[model samples]
Target: MLNLSESINKTLNNFAENTEMMWNFADDATDVLLGDLDTEIASTPYEIVYQQDRVKLKYYKSEAPVKMKTPLLVVYALINRETMLDLQPGRSVVKTFLDNGIDLYMIDWGYPTRKDRYMTIDDHVNGYMDDVVNYILKREKVPQVNLMGICMGGTFCVMYSALHADKVKNLVTTVAPTNFDTDQGLLHSWMKSVDVDRMMDTLGNMPGDLMNFGFLLLNPARLMIDKYQSFLENMNSRDFVENFVRMEKWIFDSPDVPGETFREFIKDFYQGNKLINSQMELGGKRVDLKNLTMPLLNIYGKFDHLVPPGACELLTSRVGSTDVQDVCIDTGHIGIYVSSKCQREFAPKICSWLGERDGNFSEPEVSSPVKKKTSKAKPAALQN
Candidate 1:
């Protein structure tokens, strides 16, 4: 009877301790939640050099000397805004590039309206992208510019390089899906069966909210549940809350993809797998992978579910480039750019790779006036 009483006393004490801890956590969380937080993203300063309809070219000037003779044009996917690259000062790919003396240009495929529903892959590739490249080439007075693309943007860069090989000095693709026939990812499986024509006919442009819902469905347990649960647990930390909110802004700030672009991307690339089979066409010309003769750097996340390694790894063999390198980083799709470890690997690799290939040329003078846009509150272990 004495031992039983002691056991009960111990149990009650433990429960009381846990309850006190919970109360402390709640108070701290409330304090942090009520505090002023700086959640603004894409805070890197840039100038808008060229604008065509919804697409704009952003030029990020480096205070350091330009190391590479060839300027880099970064093309991000249409689904997400390019603000993702400049997510935060510490984890920013843009800041890393600028710090490394890379003269950078990025394409901003702005929000698509109902009128943009008629825009197709051909229009984006041959029309807007080509025009952007030409403007860069002329503005910089360089014969060729380095091209890098992310996700769908990488696929676009591949097509652009193949179609206009002479204008591209080197090509870099990050987590870009080229061969989509494999069922390694749920996206590929769903896309294959998706009736894109019907979707486009009914919705005009592919809705951003719908796309976000689909991506959330991809890994609901982690992306939807686990992430928020983590937030609640760490809500007392101001830095944690700030970073969490920044990512939340980027993840949900998805823009609607153009209708015809979405339709063709689904039917041709995902369904028929025409790109890998050499059956893809744009602007009345075949996109011959053999024309990708320039130096190629293909970087993809090993654990990327949306664009699996199987989808990206096949490109090196198919491309005509003799000096090709494939780097498989141990990370997920978005993690490749934002993860802390990758901050060390990702931009440095590009700098060294480009520096080696960057031939001798005097620095070019900036002829165009710096056009500043108002600051809008927006917004990696290598295993090869």
Candidate 2:
């Protein structure tokens, strides 16, 4: 309703204000992102209680008084670092367990070199895992410790639990693939069709970057393109930028998978589909699911692409235990551990499930590490 000069002045004022606002946002974003930031995770205090050739045992001493008798030992997949479990302060599963008074232990499978290419599943389950279990039992003076594994580590735990049933009091597997017959996941199909033997032979060890590339191909739109696009849109916020960068660090911090282990897993578990059928063997011993007599908790993300529900749901039926629980959370593979909503549900569910089975034994009689045979490839079936 104003004259030409007045209208022009108003328009110019509005344009100038918007430009200034945008410039301010750009400056803030630059400082927040390019400025010195600490993206390094797994910051919770812990002690390297034990170490072997290529792996180290991290025991996170609870800040509060220890309430649980059976200490929890977390075993993560070899493909990625276990830092996902403790990404940050509020979003840390390790912190939740520590706050809940659980004496938590974690196995850090450090970077695998060419020398480790010959380290087969037998070497992992029977050799290193065995030694770690003995060390924990000797220190805690408990007959058995609770074993929880994530993704491929869960598969390893299942094998270790079956082979050495006496050492595992309870078992928990998160997004672990046991039955590989379904077409729900891209990995299952690609693995069946891929030439893993030639790949292993040529590479010596499956490079972490190569494995990550394969995972990205599963859903490029969401993982590669959309995620970063969303980050850009939200980049103006300092908190958003910080969290996004933290996750980026965790995702890219993957380790090379050993060649022998990769070859055996591809042939026996994926191609042969022997885990659920009770035909899988480790260390020359049959990995019978019926040998898993301890209380079991199998968890899978409803939208997990790497290990879909079909791959994880059949464990309860196959295991030898009468006490078994299968939990399907509303999340994806990584979200099951990192997402904020899941932070409320995931660890709580685990603590509850474990608390029910973990007897109210106030003090377990401290005892020496049971002299166990360093059996090369033999199954240590539970005592009847």
Candidate 3:
């Protein structure tokens, strides 16, 4: 009887061990599969135009009715690909604006090569961006274009608006960092300690991988470990899996920032806080934020780690636009665009806001609703 009992115990232990092994194997397989899916979803369509030196413009197009009110120009930060706006058909901010009868153009600061190490903030804000705006204005035969900027791109737009306010009919900035002095965020604080010159000297051109890694490090526990574990728990559902993969691809699709530009950004804006202080200079011209008198819409993510609400809110008070309005969404940085909840709420709000200002009377028809496809999903507040 004792011998029989020992054999049965051994068999039960083996079964438990096999179950644990299988679970681990399944987890690994799920990870590999999700990684592959992310690559496929992020490869959305885009067109490239006017490549010169290391700068290129990439954009997405949609059909528009003739006599569209104002041409919309979107400027995205150089730290990542501009495709984040048009992430997918149903989930795209670009598509939403186009569907609303707005003519759209986006700036794609193509990945900087090693030789582009000398490109400065002036080159982007005052030189290349100015040329692009003029080109669009001349081609479209419009008196002015509506300007939108995202993150660092917002900084560029603000500078451009100060210099060429007459060229823009209205100005919009989303998740833009204007006042680096606000203590509500940690990113600017960290930037204060970085020796940008030494770093630029070492790297030549600031590598995208390095910038991406730093962002991930800011929320290492959540981005690195928790996010994947949650994905593992929901791998069986394909739709959830696809959306997850697409966002992953967007997050990782970083671009190299020019060294001189990065250096100036870190020193002038982050360290010196010169832009808001009215001491900032670009291309031998002072960047006077008070000169921004065009109708301004400043949108920011309330929980954004990169550009905190406090950092972004200073513009409403500083800019000369008496019509300035601030919209603080209950979101984090990327959530301003991606979160499924945002698609339903934030996008509609933006569409309405823009439509009202442009004299567009037609209501936006809701595209096919994208179901909450992800399983084991975290709340939008937590995910962002």
How far in Å is the alpha carbon of 302 misplaced in model 3?
1.1
Task: Write down the TM-score for model 3.
Answer: 0.85
Question: Which candidate do you rate higher for lDDT, 1 or 2?
Answer: 1
lDDT of 1 by residue, 1-384 (tens): 459889999989989889988899899889889989999999889999999998999999977565677899999999888998988877788887776678899999999999999999989989999999999989999899999999999999999999999999999999999999898999999987788999899999999999999999999999889999999999989889999999999999999999999999999999888887777999899998988999999999989988999899999999999999999988899988887666666666676677678863332221111101101111123566
lDDT at 114 for candidate 2? 96
Better of 1 and 3 by TM-score: 1
- lDDT order, best first, reads 1, 2, 3
| Model 3 agreement with the true structure over 1-384: per-residue lDDT tens digits | 458889899889988989987787687667766565533542435576556566666554556473247778899998887778767767777766666666678887877888888999999988899988888888779889889999999999999999899998889898989899877777788888888899999999888898888898888999899998888776765666777877877778887889999999999989899988778998899988889998898889888988999888888898888888788878899988877666665555555556677887554532344523322222342212
Higher-TM-score candidate among 1 and 2?
A: 1
Best of the candidates, lDDT: 1
Which stretches in model 1 have alpha-carbon errors above 4 Å?
1-14, 359-381
Per-residue lDDT of candidate 2, residues 176-251 (tens digit): 9999999999899999998998999999999999999999999999999999999977877877887898999999
> Which 10 residues in a row give candidate 1 its minimum summed lDDT?
370-379
Task: Give the TM-score of each candidate.
Answer: 0.91, 0.88, 0.85
